[model samples]
Target: MKNPNGFGSVYKLSGNRKKKWVARKTISWENGKQNRKIVGYFETKNEALKALANFEYIENSKITFKQVYDLWSKKHFENIGHNRATNIKSRYKVHLSVIDNVSICDLKIKDLQKLYDNLNLSSGTANQIKSILKMIFDFAIRNEYIDKNPIDYLEVKKHKSVLERKIFTSEEIAFLWNNINLKLVDTVLIMIYTGLRIEEFLNLKIENINLEERYCIAGSKTEAGINRLVPFNHKIIPLITKRFKEKNTYFITCNNRKISYSTYRRAFIKLMEDLNLKHTIHDCRHTFATLMSNAEANPASIAKIIGHKDYKITEKIYTHKDKNELIKAVDMIN
Candidate 1:
């Protein structure tokens, strides 16, 4: 009986040899020549044929990330409550979706690390996502889709306390300015100059920026913060202009896509570690507040600029005066 095309072959070699039956597969072709690999040399044709069959079966059975996740969740979901299962599914969609079509064998630690580092998740949420990945890799290993789990090598560091208002010193600010070309340092500089919350800066859209006027409208997380006008610090005008010209929808981005908060947080942490600076993302806001206060900038303007609705007088009364005050306050940061 003839074998199917590309199924590989088992045949006896002409040379005198201890094991004459050879099983080989054509892996590639170059210069009109077949580049093949011998699976094995066997004592009998049947043995060689069996080896080829096993090789083909293994090659054909390689599973993808999505496939293994589906298989794993079937039994996993059955054992857990519907709500818990749904929550796992949600995390998988948000965090693991990037590698869905990737084969389990091809998935690498760096691939996982890139995704993990880019997210701005809390420690609990980060651990939850990591758990889901660990389960999928374990499933793959048990099923023989892959031998080693890449997740075993990954290290997820604990998040620092963001509540600590440890502001950057003038010396550290000078150091950052000198090293502005470093990755994400510009982001930190922007945060310091503009006094934006991490999320607010990340969500700043192109439409909200006025490059000519040197101001942007952005805010969130509070009634006072919503759509407030923020004047740009003179030092960061070039930085903002550079980002604006990228034509991205958001002012801050990674690979032309909206960078998630958790990813940025992780990268920010790494940056701090590299620079040997002890601070949090929220610290940039604190630095701004401190800079403004130290400069003796107007309290009304400071309150408005930082999006605090704490002024005794109604913000409606100072709206016109505050715009000029906000610009003046930003300039005073020097």
Candidate 2:
């Protein structure tokens, strides 16, 4: 029968499992063409009535995608992280004009997939878009804006892994230590010695350093960003001392501001070219792990130093045993 609101009709279907309720709405275009659509199925008759009410409201109000996204953003800003929210808002702006006039309920998976695939974005980036859509739909479903998640079955194509752990040779490490510009020499040395992520290094403060203890406190990027004390060797001590003499600030910087990752990466690329080495800034951390493993540093000790949440993750990524050492251990059993 016709809904009192005049937006749609509701019907019940018999099934072995349970009774299913369905709502249908019709839309007329400027060309005098009409299209009928089934909004959703509900498990309970009461839920179906609620769905019919919502459908009537949506159809009557002619709500837009932008309007719903804005409403969703307001309700769930805290659910998203700071870094992620920034990117999501930026991407939404780019796609807003094309989809803004479209109804929220009419947002099909194909439309989203087409938008996702047409962009010349990395797989990681595509996944982020997918995640934002998922969050939006999840909020809608939770609030009963929609009965089911339309984009739930959308598959994000996986990109081939390009990042490999490159173990820097001793010569390459020595070359980098000796050849990088003197301005960033101390900062690079600190990374080599401490294996701190770029963000952690940039955020380092003078108060975190304990000169007497020959260590510094820093946080990691991962959820394991708990404060950890990293010990410094003799080589790093001189570098830190020299920096302490030159700058009042805790970190090495150009023009009194913290160095950006892009700046460091460009400089590192030049350094790599000069040394004829092919390695990423990440190689410094891998080199640290390699050297530590070669020195027979205990996995537990290394994990604690690296602020890894568990030794198993450390073992999975960083524990590469030497062939000769393995042979020696095997011989001992014989």
Candidate 3:
């Protein structure tokens, strides 16, 4: 009755001290003085003890967003390569990293939604951020930091005018072909016909291509972007043959290692300036799908060639407006 532990003392202080149990724990010493905190009040001793145990565990083991993210970043990006890890970290530093000190249990959907709203990222990037956030929260939940993930039911949505994948019109494709010089013409044609993303095309090593098979393995990022086979057009054959003649590590070699995306991007910018054309390199892939669809290529074949897991996507997002066909249909409607 004289000596007591800070966990809580339930002694008769008044007419046989009421059976009031106060759950308490010492977080730390402040200014060389032991500082105590009251966790909660319970009706029974066992309840108070149980509460104290939970409070101790949570207080001692609470994971911050930084810790969870660090753990997740290592596992998710494991063996993914340095470039990808750097890219992932860049994205994280902008949003997720800001809340590094915030406990995962304290992470709210609204907190995340605010970050998303302010990011001004494209639909794809915003979705990616959301995915990573949800994943981190899921990890937190598994570790018992929180019972449920706040992001699991979060209602964050992409803006209506979010930047979408830019597709090149048929005429634009024709113009690019006409103006593409010999230096990078093969690069352009390979991209246009194979539906390879710029990164995929630029990063292509000899192992990723098969001259005899007339197909190139290209992809990155998603499931559709890994080890996907892109069949060549009749036109890309000659170009591939020529490139094969030159011994190089990457398909897009600039005298040595595969030309960096930045260096080549600047060159592409200069070419676009000279041609007075405005389009991202990704437009080439979109142009490929559009051209394939216009040529009445089977949807399944197009999806496979483009490495799309969902074939319907080719019909939905890849198809572009045909004014002539629209006019014909409208005339029938009238």
* Ten contiguous residues with the weakest lDDT in model 3: 325-334
lDDT of 2: 0.66
lDDT of candidate 1 at residue 108, scale 0 to 100: 84
How does each model score on TM-score? 0.53, 0.53, 0.50
The parts of candidate 1 lying over 4 Å away from their true place are 1-162, 311-317
- lDDT tens digits by residue: candidate 1, 96-180: 8888888778888998887877667778888888888999888777756788888888888885433557999999999999998
Better of 2 and 3 by TM-score: 2
Q: Is candidate 1 or candidate 2 better by lDDT?
A: 1
Question: Each candidate's lDDT (Cα)?
Answer: 0.84, 0.66, 0.68
Prediction RMSDs, each to the true structure: 15.1, 11.6, 12.9
Deviation in Å, model 3, residue 59 alpha carbon: 27
The CA-based lDDT of model 3 is what?
0.68
lDDT of 3 by residue, 233-326 (tens): 6665777887773467787787667786767777877776776777778777887777777776666666666667677764455234232332
> TM-score rank, highest first?
1, 2, 3
Candidate 2, 205-228: lDDT as tens digits: 777877775777888876554676
